[model samples]
Target: MATKNVVVDLTKREKLDGTNFDMWHRKIQYLLNEQEVLETLTIVMMRPENGNTAQHRYDLETYESWVKKDHCARFTMLSSMHNDLIGEFENYPNAQEMWNQLKISYGGTSATILRALTLKFEKYVMDSKHSMAEHLRTMSTLIRDLKAASNNLSNEQ
Candidate 1:
């Protein structure tokens, strides 16, 4: 099991004596430098607790370890992609619109996989971040979009 522990210097968030924003930024820079070293390894898994819960599977703790070691850019990348997934959901005004979009974008098992990925992303953001309730609300909105999309697909079929 290849595992890495991470240390974060959140001086800006830390209530320490003489700690300023500049110090915090500098500390973040150092953290980024360290993270660059870690990304050298292959990302065998994105999330620890994935769709499968087999004997060979690892938990979210494994994924979080990487997240902790990840640089600011990496964190931002995850955030941006998550937002994009939701945005894609929201782009459709109604179920009909969603069905049309999904029809063009995916087919068969691929469609199922794509929807599952979007839903999983919602779960991932809600689980990993501190503000659970708020994230849940966001997930709720996503769920509505997903449901609407499904309805549209059914109507078309």
Candidate 2:
């Protein structure tokens, strides 16, 4: 018989820079699901109420600790991957809070940004100073934002 070992490394994860949270979020979701620890972002374990036996109390404590530990690990790992600053969420008790904080911080105000970006996309004029490749790259980045905002540019328009 032969022995083999495999090690998986998850590095260079997509960053959550303010301009691209949607893409960052989907990639992070994939990474979390792959790790079999995605649910820690949502569920929180609660300690038992009064009238429980000592054994039951111990069990609840154990479960709570594990849940917190999992959430903390995911939270710390996630924060490090961000290009935008998320230090305000350092004290959040769970991954869910961290996720929500990102959403709240970057999510609500994006409609205005999308509108501005869309207008910019609509008004983009090619520059004679830039090479064709550079102009295309700039256009492509804008078009990606339009698509991310669920607004597509048809061939006619």
Give the TM-scores of the predictions, in the order they appear.
0.22, 0.58
TM match of model 1 to true structure: 0.22
What lDDT does candidate 1 reach at residue 137? 75
Model 1 per-residue lDDT tens digits across residues 51-116: 556533556666665556443334422222224344554544333333344345433234555456
lDDT against the true structure, each candidate: 0.41, 0.66
lDDT of 2 by residue, 62-140 (tens): 7877686666446544554553365666667777777887788766546776777677888899999999998998898
Give the poorly placed runs of model 2, Cα more than 4 Å off.
Answer: 1-13, 49-58, 61-65, 108-112, 115-142, 150-157
Prediction 2 TM-score vs. true:
0.58
Model 1: colliding residue pairs: none
The lDDT of model 2 is 0.66
Pairs that collide, model 2: none
